[model samples]
Target: MTREGRWSEPYEIFPQASGLFSHPVLVRISSQEIWLFYRKQQVGESISKPYVAFSFNSGVHWLEHRLLPPGIEGTTRNPPYVDRIRNRVYIPSFSVYESPDQELIGDSWVEIYNFFSRSWEGRMGPILGGSRNQVPIEPAIVKLTSNKLALFFRNASVEESYICLSVSTNQGISWSKLKNLPWRSYDNSISVQSGRNGKLYLFANSAPAGERLTCFSSYNEGITWNHPKLIDSGYSIDPSTYLDRQECMHHVYTSKDAQGTQRIKYYRIKEDTLLLNCPACWILEDVQESTEE
Candidate 1:
């Protein structure tokens, strides 16, 4: 998961969190608080549930409680995202449709949340400002120097699994028309960042589509990529970007064993580079303390 050996100290955060987390997201509000967003699973439903967790004093402890209400009519899947660019948090998930007995597909919704406003808005409006009939989960957003929020998403349509870009100049109130990005996003959903570097990086599967695999970054910010870099050993599915407590960045993915049990592994940022080729052993270290939503 991470590039550096925790001093080979075997540092990681797992064991307690397994098969219970989906759509994992974290935000460092300050040196003292870390915001966590995730969806808790319902027996038959896969969408409609989003939970919020917090860590105080730096991820040594954790407190998680339900954040989504009941009767939402979908399965809660996918993690939330925290944007350092605007200092707000957003979550995108698939809202399924179900018939009586929950057997059908419902309205698939993409919702975004603002930590400052404490408000939630649907992607159908100017929030995401995309023209796709359907938007795949895992939306990556970053604020450019122009102060415009550029949102990138995986196109569910067959044109290309490439990451599509859209710009919202007015703080997500209005967006530019859809623009096709030469950089595709299939294997991973996080390549968005807030940095001085002009180039952007995307994470996705380099292996053939539908096979589910690992992928790497771009030097030209979606303009051109170097080569397919492998991050996971057994094959990685969904990934998100995370910058941790020590100011170290990470590329995180959920790993599952043969028994179908899953664990979270993260790749640490070292010297501005993510070590994806090493054996995944980086652990999640969180400090837990309760904080109200």
Candidate 2:
């Protein structure tokens, strides 16, 4: 889409799936090249297989669809992460385990995609969870500092209901034990992004009014956060799509249309108001080293 609100014509790219194709995650690889990751599933089924397609002419034409690794379900709210320096894209996915008796056993897998090699990685290696029905599903990742990356997930366990956090130094290869975040979020999707001002902004629904969308800021690379500022209320928001700019933060959320259908909405919040009451906020001049990994 152009800045003037002009939208390009839509085209069919993944029309060969048996049931349905949904959850398109777009990442721009270059001025003319882009990548899209999506899911295909059978009718009335819950599981979905992940597939990816590349567009070389700015999405005007898409290449052949390639199915990602099996054993994991694709994501709807979790978008693939692009590391421009490394020329790799990281995808977050999860899968369930069932017993021989057809009973749900445990949520035993979490998958990550290495786009350079066109392969998948990551499993339920170290995160803590109980049963198949109660575990983290969506994983949102952000680079905190050099050699440091953070992963935020939406978990189903009551005790670990809040958005969970884990850190990795060697990228997503291995992670530290999971820890519960202080803020509460809808058990759907969470958003974490590095702001242009060198701070981290986390978007989630807070307690008492989980329906109200709120934003929090962390200056020391997610070590601590300032009080949340409410963005909007009364409507549910999937804080998945995010954009960071020098002046403001932009994100796309899903809301209900007048006809009761879900529609994508765009919103922007300026950075000045976000740090109104923040303590010891780091200024751009104070940032000497590149925090991006």
Candidate 3:
């Protein structure tokens, strides 16, 4: 979110994070050392475990591995994203399957991984008072200009769905109330980053006929957002965005059910043109033509 640059070819980045994997996820670069936030679900009932991959060669080759605790053993839910706040590195992810109906009801445990100790400690959920009505998932961590960390996620239900936000003062140790956002979507994942002028650029999934990941920009620190805009023509979702050295936004996503073939997409933004014919991206030429006009 500091500067913008193009993304290089993102090869099969997560060989370790496979099997029973439901929601595959990723995060941005490191302020000090560059790393990838991902998960592994190699077991049926086992939850997805949080993982880290260090990259020094511009992601051409990476040191991908699993990060574990001292005693307790279980997997993570989503990709664990890390951001620095006041010199402390905070790793955040949600845990599931440890209890009954933990995922659907989201009686989860939000945890933080400590780099200094190489250990992850956390607080149990039933978060937001376990309202018996609200179901929250898919957390996105944002570092504000003032160094406070705000975790935003989508609140979903067959009855109702909305976006929500929570704050932590001590670096993902604890969370505040889980409040709802003004809008909702079917399966929209958001990519949020700090803009140069203190605004926030949030890319989300809007309700089009195909329902793809759309765009929204905020000027007043996420208090409100601009109208949604389409980023590409395919059925793109699960946005993970980062800015590089030249101020251009780099986005990586999964192009699924497009022309009946699924593939990962790596793309970037330069003045206006959207490029997608990389080795990583899957082409939905027919869908693209259909969505036009």
Candidate 4:
């Protein structure tokens, strides 16, 4: 789609010859170059892995199909996020290990793709949910500072669910112990981006009642977060929003239409309105309610 809301005709970007190719993650490499990393899965199978391709002409013509390191089982809903500041691409994917009773255990992992060498590095976790029947997946990572990286994930199950946080000081090579956050996250989609105001903004689906996109800000770099402010509603889930250089936020999510069909939705918000709506850590607890509404 163009800036004027003109939709372009869909074409086959990359065709899989053997198995199913799906779950594409896109990143802008340069002015005219775009990079895509996707998963390839066999039909009727529960396992998948990552593959890479590039287009120098803005996704019109793609070339080079290569597999990324440490492709695991299961699936990836939100693709890898690119951190231009650190020049590394981070993917939060998971694999499942099963037992004889047909119980499935999920372990989340991270893969780093270096820009200069065009290669990938992989790391498995202990990310958030490690106990039995508690599955942690769909991780969203952000560079909290020049030396710190934060990994947030959904501690998911059929019962109660919420988001979990973990931090790494040495650029995601290893992670600290997982800490459960206060905010509820029923669905496993959380996006984190650094704002121009030097705060980290998180967009996710707040849970326990209604399904809505909620925004939260952290001034202390993931140590704590202010009370969340609901951004939008109407069965929104799996949010991926980013802050641009011009200070405008671009958000996209999975939504359902009137006929029960799933669709992609986009939203554009100013940085000022977001910062105002989602207060920082310095605000008093009593004053937080007055600022959000």
Strongest candidate by lDDT: 4
Q: Candidate 2 regions off by >4 Å?
A: 3-18, 43-47, 97-134, 207-210, 257-261, 278-293
Per-model CA lDDT versus the true structure: 0.50, 0.64, 0.53, 0.67
Clashing pairs in 3: 4-244, 4-247, 5-244, 48-75, 48-76, 49-76, 204-214
Q: Which candidate, 1 or 4, has the higher TM-score? A: 4
User: How close to the true structure is residue 79 of candidate 1, measured as C-alpha lDDT?
Assistant: 35
Candidate 4 Cα outliers beyond 4 Å, as residue runs: 1-9, 15-21, 40-49, 67-70, 73-88, 99-104, 120-134, 145-147, 157-160, 208-210, 277-293
| TM-scores of the models, in the order given | 0.58, 0.77, 0.65, 0.76
Query: What's the distance in Å from true for residue 82, model 4?
Result: 4.4
Shift in Å, residue 271, candidate 3: 9.3
- Candidate 2 lDDT over 1-293, as tens digits, reads 67887876776765555788777777777788888878778789986778878898988788978786665455556555667777666555555455698654333234555556666545534444433334565777677655566667776555446666666666666665556667654655677877654577888777443367777787666666677777767565777646544566667777776687877778766766777876743232221222222
Error of 3 at 143 (Å): 0.5
Q: In candidate 1, residue 248 scores what lDDT?
A: 65
Better of 1 and 4 by lDDT: 4
Residue 108, candidate 4: alpha-carbon lDDT: 74
Rank list by TM-score? 2, 4, 3, 1
How many clashes in each candidate?
A: 36, 0, 7, 0
